[model samples]
Target: MFNTYRLIGAAAALALSTTTLAAVSPQDAAKLGSSLTPFGAEKAGNAAGTIPAWTGGITQPPAAYKTAGQQHPDPFADDKPLFTITKANLAQYQANLTPGQIALFKSYPDTYQMPIYPSRRSGSAPQWVYDNTLKNASSAQLLDGGNGFADAYGGIPFPIPQSGVEALWNHIARYRGSYIVRRASEVAVQRNGAFSLVTSQQEALFKFYDPKGSYADLNNVMFYYLSFAKSPARLAGGAVLVHETLDQVKEPRQAWAYSAGQRRVRRAPNLAYDTPISAADGLRTADDTDMINGSPDRYDWKLLGKKEIYIPYNNYKVSAPGVKYDDLLKVGHLNPALTRNELHRVWVVEGTLKSTARHIYSKRTLFLDEDSWQAAVVDQYDGRGELWRVSLAYLKNFYELPTTWSALDVFHDLQARRYHVQNLDSEESSTVDFSQAIPDDGYFKPAALRRRGTR
Candidate 1:
């Protein structure tokens, strides 16, 4: 939890400070499309399966929630897709391609090789992908989450399956952890009334928790992603997303989505007036530039538990689209998104560590997953904790609800090395609507992020 990061790799030279940002113009390599899991997971393993964790962990009894009259349906298209991606059926499916996904769909990237914007419905790919089907949805998944938290409304035909350009850039860099619902009128009219969203193959009828347990634990709680449209290489539309920001937040903002090709959605007006980082300083680390609504912080009331042990989420379980659940947990305290959940089943904590940790591996460790708070697994140590890094996160049920899958595994054991980031894009966009009011030139300088570009 707090070994301070357990310094020892030889910690030193730490005195960070680098203001003067002002650049903005970076949306090309898919805006550097990083941080889906910007290196998470370090420990939490051991439960049979041999030191590689997360294999479904919902304890039991948690499924059977329909609610007749009030309102509730598309909790991700009524829980379906164990498989179904398109572009004219994608050759009865190709076992869900993955060699890093045929090397990014044949290296296609002219904005993901577009030649069929012919009105937005031409998407075709087969013949054995004769051309590797170009590539470019650039990633996405959070179209609608059955109203996950409330007032976050986005919906746009996502709950994806997969096609080409890695199912459109992994469905726009993973629309983000699909599944949500919580509404007491946002705590009785905006105290932040619980919310959620989903629609594209509905299914969220889960309110059991251990229902005499046999299989379905309601996908544990909900929040899941990983695509090749449900692998083995069924590589149809393709995706691997993860994104949920509010950056160490109190209110940083995210949920924007508009991309017609990086058109605009990016956030950051003052990111709630800057100043909030907890860790990460360099080494390809840019997570704390403070972008608020444009996105960068995944909610700040962290907790990361002490350590229960158990790493490697979803060890390898492909069967989403409304996941029923068999196993996939990398637990600790819990996932930790918005806040408040005092050690639920047992054990507690929320998150704290960002007076600027400057991540190049600042000795991090977290293995939460008490049902759904989320953290799963993460443990990096470089200031000298002598572990290097290792990450894992797992959660299932994409459209039907309860999702979160970090699956990040990096072990540099000093050098026998390793690398991973299967984040694929998470969700909970970060919410917004503090009430109309949108003008800081409309997103702070640099021509307002090159006239806005997060489409």
Candidate 2:
């Protein structure tokens, strides 16, 4: 892991030559509602009619979903798989399958399969978010290369993205709920099918999504997050607090940790990049936490256009209240029986490590769901240019917030035959609370971490 000082020094040097790109023109921005979805996705369905047109997405919870904390019921529960792609028929679907996905079939031909379902353009954002996104199309600009964004507030930074980094910025700034609280678990499953769950109660206040906050009010800070471990006795009471920054070049992400054993709070600068996630047991990296996070300075990103592919989407079943983690987790991959894949158009972006940069992943190809601007799949390659890890984000619409976000994220290490999954909370009494009140700034300060860690 790069130490804090070194990382900061590297960021400063990279910021010097960071090219500034102009925002989309007003003429192009005008296409948002006429020919594109308000979020900049194509408004019409594909010529083949495989992917449906975007109507206003599911904005209200089903009648059965009566409370804020209940598991999200699948609105498309009655739908059936359109087709199943297995090793035998993999060649027929090669055009839609990512190389890393095809590799999965080759590695586990007997068990790996993709049950492709009809595409549903179910991703939606609040009306205010849509309005702000339109404003951002002509205002948002990348600063310090792509390490920072300016002239943007409360919505996707670059809805009509002109570059790969801008597309990533949209994903990074996509609207989830302003405030949320949930109990979830992370597990590192070994090749032998053995695993232990590390449960955590997490709360987050997305300053970028705050309806009242403006670009000036952000002060370079994007969000404040607090997470406290609740299980695996040894990890209980351990907590982490993060102040994710918008312009990391100006102020690197501020993070602190409270160790139960020491009963003390300490700065945690190694929470970014290839640093092994402690709870993940080295199976995943810190940058891989949310499919992708932190600075994009280490790699030169290129927009690879869009393609139709099978990606995990509207995955309410994978997060059903009573589903056991054991049933979802398997040796090589998550149980395919519970996984749902759909054919949707995704914006593909490739990131290759800059010669001056340092990290484990030499190359990474990320697929962002056009509807939500969230990464659905990331294929990571190692130093030798060999495929190493595949990360998948299973998404579902939190209808109350009416936002599409990850229900579960999995990182599969092909070489080790081990995988780590986060956001598994089926066993918890409550799922997620989107209506949680916004927390005071003081609640997320470093000093308060010590008090919150005494769990």
Candidate 3:
């Protein structure tokens, strides 16, 4: 275990000295798709063999899947847990767990547990994405002291990341198809397990991943998003539009909110940073939407290297068709029986709040899955440096698009003994539709919000 840590640390140190904020050398870039996975993950498995080597992740949908809009069936439904981790035996597995994972075991000694399944590196992107990632290895670079990146689009930027900021940028730019539409619900489960659903119709067009677009065409815009609230009288008819800029320092995120009550559209600058997500009932912040989003300027990032940890992965059962939300959302956490945990190598990045910068989370430690470039787990600290919240992204491959994305994101507030969940659409008419045609930018503007809002 120490050897693995040392090797990863040494590699990171070398990259820092050689690459800095610039693209890696041709020799190092050649390592990608050879010794390293196309996305820059180690191609070889660990010595223990618990984690297998990556062999071109899920290239096609499972036999169980019938069509594009149907709920994704579990590809590994026959697999069973090798063992389970609980508070009683937590010490034995403590080394493989994060601070937040350990805290959860302590928070719910009897109820909270992790069912360990065999590691399956089922993360893949389209051939075009892989091609772009290889090209980005020697061209993509950070801009303005790591506030943003340049000369990279349509693939993982900084695949051979030398710094924490670069690794975070990879997650922000990870492919999720060009356009998608879904009707999902968010809920803040109270201490007693009761919750109210705040549902929305969400649409996003990933300008960074547009096939016909180029880095110059992006003009600093990462993506365009529009969300219209639909549910329980109060939130119904409200809408939000966001133009997520790639270089937030160059041009801050442009956002607009439309009120059904006031029947007016207004600029919403507070939608970024630590502003409370009203739909989350104060349990989550705007930055916590996709585990962590928005600018990383408020924090000083440090690359802590890599570690083999048990994280939530390939969790299809949690969002399986016909699975009611009540059956999945328990008191302290999601139903452990439905979730799957696997041991996998992950890059650890620590973000410490800059002394001059202000945010609710004083510190954050992110565990990014090597195969997917997704932050699988995040431990957030409060002003006093206490473990305040734990965030988990239950990931699964959308084989149709062949991209890995979170099925559901859960944020656990240890002090409040409550949790908030996003992207729960099991009962909806359809799952995420990646085949949706990309809409024009006009559809995501402030004027469109008022036109789309339906009270």
Candidate 4:
């Protein structure tokens, strides 16, 4: 097994020009991992020590990939920034450093800054994808899903262009859901802070009749798994629940325009997810997600470098009929007339498809859009090393909410030209942010898959 820390750690040793591995204190290393960057300093003309702007330039594509412009990476010997911050030098560039960046750099010795890459529109990628990218890039942010389940579940805040509104939407997407609602305060919760979320059904909102009485302590929280674009029974319906965003909301939230299964608009907490985490395999939070156009043994992921990628927004005049805004990640099916006619992009990821023979396309490469951290397009190759599938994501505008590449549609060139689309954004819900605590759900459990129709 590739030891993540060891491999990355050894790279540090080599860069420092040391023959032996340098033993950094675990506490310091952990601090770096939490907030510090993992890059080195660029000694260009920053005597003023300005926080680095687009050193790679603005929204223009590189003239050529190999010719250097932005693709040329000048890696550092150690985890530092192309720019460093010091008390004396902080005046000029302080504006650019995020509060988190300033604190971490001051606290740790080798704290680095996350390198910034040029936007996908940097004059690279296919021509057609560019036209659409410009139109959709704006208005991209998170929203609320409201009590993602049950009768009282209604209304949500989404696609808020204003940073303030967007921030609140993100707050809703992150906190509201079926969970251990530790405390519900009037403000935001931190990573280590205690708070509970509504769950996927089986509980109702606690009405405070007496703050200190038996009603004060409740066992369940009401919530639901908003089905974005869950595949048909053949593909396994179980893929629906795990990646629930509307299910994750702060206090204020919104709902999808259409809810397919019910033939009527449904509320949050409609379908509950009540189970134990001990039933799942070794997976982390946000790992219990659905697969798009996948087979039994064909899902291997690798972390690649961070590359700027441009993706489609509201470019296409067409609309996805059965999905919602939140189901962008797990698409169901798509109309095949589009061809490779959708959006194209420049992404950064090194994930590969599993080597199993079950999946027609045994090899896959994911391209993630950095501006939004969305996996926009994918190249799927068959066992024979042939390009078998090409997947594209289509996003929609939910009011003022951010233009989300909410839907992922893939078409296989091999076999019968069969296609599968995983719509993480079904238009019913948008901004599907996987909760930090959900890596513990047992939805992927063998027994749950066997239960069929359990959702």
Q: Highest lDDT: which candidate?
A: 3
With candidate 1 superimposed using the best TM-score fit, by how many Å does residue 20's alpha carbon deviate from the native?
26
Find the candidate with the highest TM-score and give its number: 3
lDDT of each: 0.23, 0.87, 0.90, 0.27
Model 2: which residue pairs collide? Answer: none
TM-score of model 3 (CA atoms): 0.97
For candidate 3, give the lDDT. 0.90
> Each candidate's root-mean-square deviation in Å?
22.7, 6.0, 1.9, 21.1
In candidate 1, what are the lDDT values of residues 1-455, reduced to their tens digit? Answer: 11122221211112112211111122421222131111112223334322333233232213443331112122222222233223334333323221221222232222111111001000111211111111111222221111111111111111111211111112212223222222110000111112111111111111111113211332222222111122222221222222232122333332222232434444333322223211111111223121011222221222322323222223212222232111211111111121111111101122223446333444343443332334433444455544443333333322122233322221112222222222221221211111122222123233333342321
| TM values, all candidates | 0.22, 0.95, 0.97, 0.31
Query: For model 3, how does the per-residue alpha-carbon lDDT over 1-455 read when each residue is reduced to its tens digit?
Result: 33244334544533132223779999999998999999999999989898999999899998978777789999999999999999989999988999999999999999999999999999999999999999999999888778888888789998898888888888888999999999999999999999999999999999999999999998889999989889978888888999999878789999999999999999998889999998898999999999999988898787778889999999999999899999999999999999999999998888989899999999999999999899999999999999999999999999999999999999999999999999999988789998877888888878778877753
Which ten contiguous residues of candidate 1 have the minimum total lDDT? Answer: 113-122
Residue 117 displacement (Å), model 4: 21
* Model 1 misplaced regions, further than 4 Å: 1-172, 177-376, 385-394, 398-455
- Cα lDDT tens digits for candidate 4, 348-406: 22334434424344555555432232345555555687554454455332211112334
Give me the runs in candidate 3 sitting further than 4 Å from their true place: 1-20
Candidate no. 4 TM-score: 0.31
Please give, for residues 152-270, the per-residue lDDT of candidate 2 as tens digits.
Answer: 99888888777778888888888888999999889999889899889989999999888888999988899998999889899889999999999787888989999999999999987
Instruction: Give the 10-residue window scoring lowest on summed lDDT in candidate 2.
Output: 1-10
